[model samples]
Target: MSGTAELAIDAAFAARLFDELAARTGDAPGITRAAYGEGEQIAHDMMIREAQALGLTHRIDPAGNLYLTYEGRDPALKPWVVGSHLDSVPHGGNFDGAAGVIAGLCAVRALIEAGLRPRRSITVMAIRAEESNWFPLSYLGSRAALGLLPAESLSTPRSDTGLSLRAHMSRLGLDPARVGVGQVHLDPAELHGFIELHIEQGPVLEAAQVPVGFVTGIAGSFRYRAARILGEWGHSGAVPRGHRHDAVFALADLITALDRLWGEVLEGGESATITFGEIGTDPALHGFSKVPGEAGFCLDVRSPSPACLERIHAGLLHIVAGIEAARGVRFNLGARSGSAPARLDEALRARLAAVAEGCGAGFTELASGAGHDTAVFANAGVPAALVFLRNQNGSHNPDEAMEMADFAVGADILARLLARDDND
Candidate 1:
């Protein structure tokens, strides 16, 4: 253990930051930090101001990812990067993405206040556009920084504004062309490791009665955002059951079949999740007395196991074929988008676990069901670890509640980890 283990995390600093964030970005029902929008800009600016106050060097990439570095004894060693994204889902809780960034700041602040600098620098990152609700892309800022995002994605439009990503970057005076050409800002090989501290976003930590969790892996997903089922419309009273070709009934059959497959997968001791997040018929065309002719839906399937993901996808195709043949419906599954599962660095995880144990913070190992920017780093060949703070009422909603005490415990662990000398 490092001498900084005796130093306490600056939790008060984190509280003030969180309160200020909520006040400035509050969106009535909750907070709305739209990706690359005004609210998100406010967050980045705030982080910059805080970095300036801490006397840390700051830099911004072409994609507007923020990096604030606290200098250490050695300038040549690869820095330890700590951070998470700053954008949130529409009307989302205040803590979902912001907590991780704040935790990074808190950890760095603690080290600085203790008058101790380790061998390698510590960089607190503020990633952007993590909420796919705004940009329809995964790990937008992180991928851009690591030069992993495809050039075609630059033309993808924001959901609410319908403006291309390139246009948005230009609006903020950022170089979209550089990002599109795969300019690297934070190279994976130049970092010692990456650590992200985020809220649990689920009941797992709370149920386990632990204040924090060390994540083992993050779930990958396959998504169909604009799938549709088409069939002939007819009068409900006139169409016989055998003769009717109903799109709604066909959708129902598809859902039932998928549900059965999901249950079977679970019974087989495999982990997977299937969700029909959005499903409905066209309100303008359908009537109460009419048999629906068309229905649209979106599907999101996730699993930590790549083989399991493939198995489920295969079952879905088979089920869709049978449903189409029996109901005489045409299925149009739109462009598929997804990411592969990520495995965290086991050695780094063990080190953090030891640090947490030394700090007397209760923690357990688990796998994350939600996607995060940490997965981007792990996929880029960087050693990465994710720490989850206990939160209540789930996440991506206004009711999410993470205790400040729990956050302090997590931050303390991070501070201890960063304050240790490389030789130790």
Candidate 2:
């Protein structure tokens, strides 16, 4: 138990937690743990039960963020906080955010089983509402905990329920009044460091046949969730091609323009991704015989470079203007929301790589194209690091296939990192 090879993770415990989560929150195609909803509450309650069983002290913040701490021998040192969000997208795979919290819990369990106490306490945080699909805001729970969430954000409505964030918090018996006042539950200066373990959510590690990855940085994003195009509805057979003002055609033009712009950006030695995730015509207002007069869509753009984001945004505006003038349509893009790109802690990343090597875990250094709560922590100057475990079939879907063995490797690295006494 003293050597790196002997350190072990409680995989059985992790498995039970995962199984229970999927069983309780199971939707049709996959699992659904909506942020600040019933499913997410089930996951949080499960974690609380497990923490109590592990003899850990637990606390819940006003924003409904849960923290479970395993005390160390020393009281003066800043504790290491390890975890990710518990909420998932609609019909999303179970392992996306849950893996990080389970990994943290397993790491602490390993130390306790080995009869070793580190100098700094270890706290596993189960963050609320990381999925922007539920709420339009990015990194909602993390930003609120850090006191960086704007007061106006409290009035933003949840997409599904159409309830304001403040109202939702009240439903959960949480203190939204305190949350709106910019109260800080987690101060950056008081933390030793933050570590988040998540599924790769892409094909990088899977294609490379690697078990894990230490992220160098995370991409920032700008999203318009309630964008719409408006035109006049007319008879399909009666309206001439030139005289028609079709919203569907206008949307198509916009998509095509953005795709071309995305390619140009890539060709110019810039990295960026643009996605139109949701697009459709209103079922209640439209008919097969009539030209569609309105369409709603969502736009998401991400890049690690701030300049790239701005350039694409400008391109988008230009495209919108051209389409409006030509198609005789009006574009109404609702309130814009986004997050800044984050550069993780290089020193902590190096230390993790060393630990991975020492533990015989295969790892590679890469940049994350997907957004994560780790970005929030790093941008807040918390010395954060994101560890990605290899998975198949991508993420945010029903087919996310993360092997238990790969999870163990990532958990082992976390355990070893937290078990060490010396702080670099």
Candidate 3:
């Protein structure tokens, strides 16, 4: 609505898109939607529609990533790609990934409506699985696009559920090998820059009274699912003190040990967190599964830097192994998901900051506390930047939002960044 300055965005379109996104989130029939479900497809369709309405060329990657391209002055240039994921964590807010996608769409709207054309083409992509429950890790689609996708991901199992990613892809008519790494020509601009507009998904910016932010770099994640203990379940009241194996009790011991090591990690000020985030017992018994069976649970050991995570992982695994041995619990440690820390494009960051200043959008430099698809480009050697909007504390919940005015400012900044030759 601000008729485009050097760079501007359509606040009205962004708000409309956000509302539409909320509508699409539950358009399909289910309480929870995983990566390849019908719900995700519906979500993908809504994004495609927005792109079509904008008159941008549209396509979906073999991995189900949706891209809406806006032609620049030179139609031949590899476009400056923007936008984020459309998937959400189980009950996540509609705005987390959705806002960024809309922001990208609005970027183009602002540019075209402002009656400006650039040397580089522009694209808004709604990548898949950034919040995937099926992949068991983040950034699957973008990694594939950047050629960093693991060869083994196709056969990788999601938890103990028998579904393999390969099978899911097959069902969706996608061959996993070619998913994120498809036919887009990485033109001059693409070689140098990539920008993503996303909600802050945390309380910091809004609480600080800032309307926008220039991200320093996104933090990395290092985690291995810990099957730290395996114990036999027995009759609760009948099991003798030393003669029986109470698997839950041993798991409790392991959890406490993990807590202590986590305390040490917190004390180091390295932005580390070790969460026993999820768990599964032998049976979901009403009151009795008294067969004296097995017990298990998961552990999430994560940190922003790969180095710090590695150190913490090594020490914690050692301590956990020790706990397993000492507490009469058996251990079956599972494999770890490999992670790379992303250091954002500095030149892009500076340009974005300048854009924020020009737009009069108060902003702060910060780090992304969550995993994002932008890291895929960083891991694959592309210059990438993230623009974060404000959200209060409710990530992975139903109440996420980006203030209309704040989102508009961030969009303007993103447009400027995209329009600049700002990559180093």
Candidate 4:
């Protein structure tokens, strides 16, 4: 096939893969491909087959990360790795990780079809357990790859669910003892670069009438769990409103204030988001006697800029201080997840931007507010950049959608980028 014909064919295959996984949304919510679930394995199987068909060798690391390598003409240069993760949030969109995986596969296919091997090796990864809702360790695959995970992590118990992560490793017929096997040793400048193509997962691309976006930086995240204040539990009529500390009542006030802070953060010229996701209280507030004990809620904040994040952090401290004084209640706060801001490899980003323009695709630049495996690599000092495909209206929701044509366009851009010289 001609060069143009080959690019078109591989791009079409990527689009088909998106449709195949996206159509699996059963009902009521977004994707449920939590770590090591059936859905996750299905996605992995398809990717393996696709890689095998294209004549690439595949290996599943002890961490469930799938690496597919295609030999290049030159054996001396470090491999050029292109990929993203495959696991999704509880109800995440299909294009988030799957699109990146298929796009890399397509890019390699396009290159091979053109019969042009690179000056370096090409490795494609479909990392596992990035969502981390079920597992305590987020970025499970990348951590294993970089040897960033501690030995204690392997022995950490899973949630109430029967699937312990180490058990999952064993089921795959791999030894958990080999969990951090290949990651320990690495050359600082070893990898030419790592690139990820993912859905924008926000409305920016579609709103701007663009097809692709580049990541200039990635946001830092702060996940906090805070306890609420509660007054004594008594008969509804027995105690006066002023006398009760009602933990839920106090929590309700904080929730509303934080909700309002979200809008304020957006107006301050920073891409920031806050989610007050989970809440719990003591005693059954429903049925018979209203048992009242302690009530707590989780809060998460994200911002693409480090300076902006610090501002938000300061504002949060102010809010917490005020609550402590006015309510006479201690504001218990602790972080469950937090990561410093990450900047993309500028040279790598320039390369992709040039390729996007060459493909004649409308493009825009953006900072990723969502965390991913790419962010993890950058954290580990591996130079990395991201290409974000346009996300339809919804992303983490079950109704998440994106145009197939956009996927095809993104594949073309990735192929062009991979076909370029890294050290150039």
Top lDDT prediction, candidate number: 2
**Steric clashes per prediction:** 0, 0, 4, 8
Q: How much lDDT does each candidate structure score?
A: 0.92, 0.92, 0.70, 0.74
Cα lDDT of model 1 by residue, 235-321, tens digit: 999999888889999999989999999999999999999999999999999999999899999999999999999999999999999
Candidate 4 Cα errors over 4 Å, as ranges = 1-6, 22-30, 155-163, 180-188, 225-231, 256-271, 280-292, 306-318, 321-325, 328-335, 422-424
Model with the higher TM-score, candidate 1 or 2: 1
Global local distance difference test of model 1: 0.92
lDDT of 3 at 238: 79
lDDT, candidate 2, 1-424, per-residue tens: 2444456897888999999999999997999998899999999999999899989999999999999999988867898999999999999999999999999999998888888778899999999999988888899999988998889889988889999999999999999889989999999999999999999988999888999999999999999988999998999999999998899999999999999999999999988899999999999999999999999999999999999999999999999999999999999998788889999999999999999998778889999999999999898889999999999989999898999999999999999998887673
Model 1 segments more than 4 A misplaced: none
Instruction: Report the C-alpha lDDT of model 4 over 9-36, residue by residue, as the tens digit.
Output: 3556776777677666332465667677
TM-score of 3: 0.88
lDDT for 94 in candidate 4 is: 72
- lDDT (10s digit) by residue, model 3, range 112-198: 777766668888888877775667766877766655566767776654357887777778887676643343423323554678878
Residue 6 miss distance in model 2 (angstroms): 3.8
Task: State the TM-score for model 4.
Answer: 0.88
Residue 235 local lDDT, model 3: 73
Q: Which candidate is the best by TM-score?
A: 1
Per-model TM-score on C-alpha atoms: 0.98, 0.97, 0.88, 0.88
Is 2 or 3 the stronger prediction by lDDT? 2
Residue pairs that clash (backbone atoms under 3 angstroms), model 4: 29-398, 30-91, 30-398, 31-91, 229-247, 230-247, 231-245, 231-246
